[model samples]
Each structure stands twice: as structure tokens, then as C-alpha cells.
Target: MATRGTQILNPRTGQRSVFLQTAQDTGGALFQMETFHPAHNAAEPEHTHPFQESRCQVLTGTLRFRVGGVERTVKPGEAIVIPPGVAHHFWNDGEVEAHAIQEFRPALNIEDFFVAYFALARDGKLSDGGIPKSVLQLAVLLKAYDRVLRPTNPPRFLQRVLMETLGPVGRLAGYRPDYI
Candidate 1:
């Protein structure tokens, strides 16, 4: 379980996530976090969660969210809910920093994903945009959290096939699932 106030920086999108409520604190019901996104940061790639829903409330600056083909700019105090299996992504579109609170239902291992990903960034194993430098590394990381992140582009079938084929190769190359 993540401790309260635990913070992680995602190098790829220039967002800092500070955990507020963790799965353990809520008995596995939910996870809540406060995120600070730098101005004009890149958007998270459109993705779907197979078993979790998410809610986001903008606290400051401007945020743009695209959910299920609908795009909206959320200002301070505005909020949005993303249903499970719906394709969604977000970006900081304001001239200043954007602060938002995000909550995930049925917590899952989303927190762990952040920890591992950020650890990779700290170790210089990721690109400037936060993507793993190696294809095998990306495969291993994504395969470990397949249930939580399903990219919407390039078709799900192709993504699955590629991941499935690469997962073993990544493992054989000594990629472990956890970074910390």
C-alpha cells in the first residue's frame, strides 16, 4: 500500500502525482491522488481500464480531457467521470500549471504502476517523454499491468498480439515486473 503523501514524478508527461488515499486505507475500495501537471504537458495516450473507473476534478489551471470520443476543457472546480472500458486521456492545456484530484474505483495496482514507472525514470531507463528506452522494457512493464492499461490506438487485437509475443522475450532478457 502507498503511504499518504507519497509522490511520484512521471517524466513522460511532466506530471507529479501525490497519493492521498490508498487502497489499504480504504480497504481496497479506491485510490485518490492529487496531480500537478506542468503547463503544456503532453497528454496521456488514450487508454482504457478493463476493470476500473476514474473521476477527475480540476483544482487549478486548465485541463483538457478526451473521453469516449468527446473532448472537453475543464476549468477549476470542473470534474469528469470516465467509465471503465471507455477510451480516455488528459493533458494540461493552460499557460500555467494544472492541479487536479483523481480517484480510481477498485484501486487495483495503479499505484504500483506509478512507482515502478517513476523508478525507471529515476534510473535513466526511460526516454525524455517517460517511455522505456527499450522495447523489451516497455513490453515487460505493460505486460505486468495488462489489466490496468489498454491502449486504444492500433487496435486492441494487434496490441495484444505484440505484447503477448514480446512479454516472454522481455522476461528472457531478465526484465523483472517490479522496479522497486
Candidate 2:
């Protein structure tokens, strides 16, 4: 684990990511961070987490959220909480790139996923449109997340469509996290 006294650094990739363990003195417990995806989209599904709950705050662009059997729209500066074990999915519903702060409980190994994705993305390891393939492996990896975190995405078919179809287009459309 990174020491709490360590200083965090920002990457040129456009993210201000930091480790909460470094903030233990500040009463940090939840995994929190702001993310900006330059023209990104989701291959997400209506799913739930077994233990984790998350919140999304739209800082820019339109964030379309579907959760708990209801669909809601969140604009800039707006937020929504997704309780654990409720079906949910979302996407950037705007012309410009989107920005949002995603807060997750227990700081679930979610950051590990992004770290891997960005590493691959940096090396052009993703498939057509930066997805690594029309079929996103990330979604597949996330499917197993059901055993660890609260279910957040939906079914595999729906996830396939969102990740393979929608996610690819977003990546091809210049959906680079740091670029936004």
C-alpha cells in the first residue's frame, strides 16, 4: 500500500487520480475521484454491486442514468446515488466529451481496472475505436465483479451491445480519458 504521507501526482493523460490510502489522516475511507473522458461512451449494463455503492456527479455534459428500474437524467453539477444491488447503467448523452466524479464504497479494485485500461490504451492495445476489440474485455472482466462488488452493470447480452457496439463508437470518436 502507498504510504499516507506520499504525495500524489497528476498524469498528462488528463486525470487527477490519487490514492485514498494516502489521505488516511484526513478521514478518507471511500474511494473518490473526478474523471473526465474526452468523448467517451459506456458499454455498461443495468447491474448491481454486492457490497459497493457508487455515486456519479456530472461536472460537464449530460449523464444519462438508468437505475432501480427507473431512468433519470443528470446534468452538470447534478448527482445521483446508486445503492448496492440495484440494476444501473449510464452514458454520456452530449455532443461534447463528458466529465464526472465517481465515488465508490470500499474503494473497490475499480481503480485497478482503469489503470489497466489506460496502460493498454496508451499502447494502442485496445481494438477498433480503442476498445481493444468490438467486444470489450473490460466488460467481461467486470462481469466477474459480481462476486466482489455490488452488481452495477446488467446482463451479458446488454453489456455486449453497450461495450462492443456503443463503447467502440465512443472510443473511435476520441473517447480518451485524458484527452477530455
State TM-scores per candidate.
0.89, 0.55
lDDT of 1 by residue, 25-135 (tens): 888789899999999998866788888999999999989989998999999999998989999988988899999999989888887877887788778897664567888
lDDT string, candidate 2, 69-151, tens digits: 78777888899998776777766655776677777776555555445555555565554433444244444444434333433
The candidate 2 region of ten consecutive residues with least summed lDDT is 5-14
Question: Residue 109 in candidate 1 has what lDDT?
Answer: 83
Query: What's the TM for model 2?
Result: 0.55
Best by TM-score: 1
lDDT of each: 0.84, 0.55
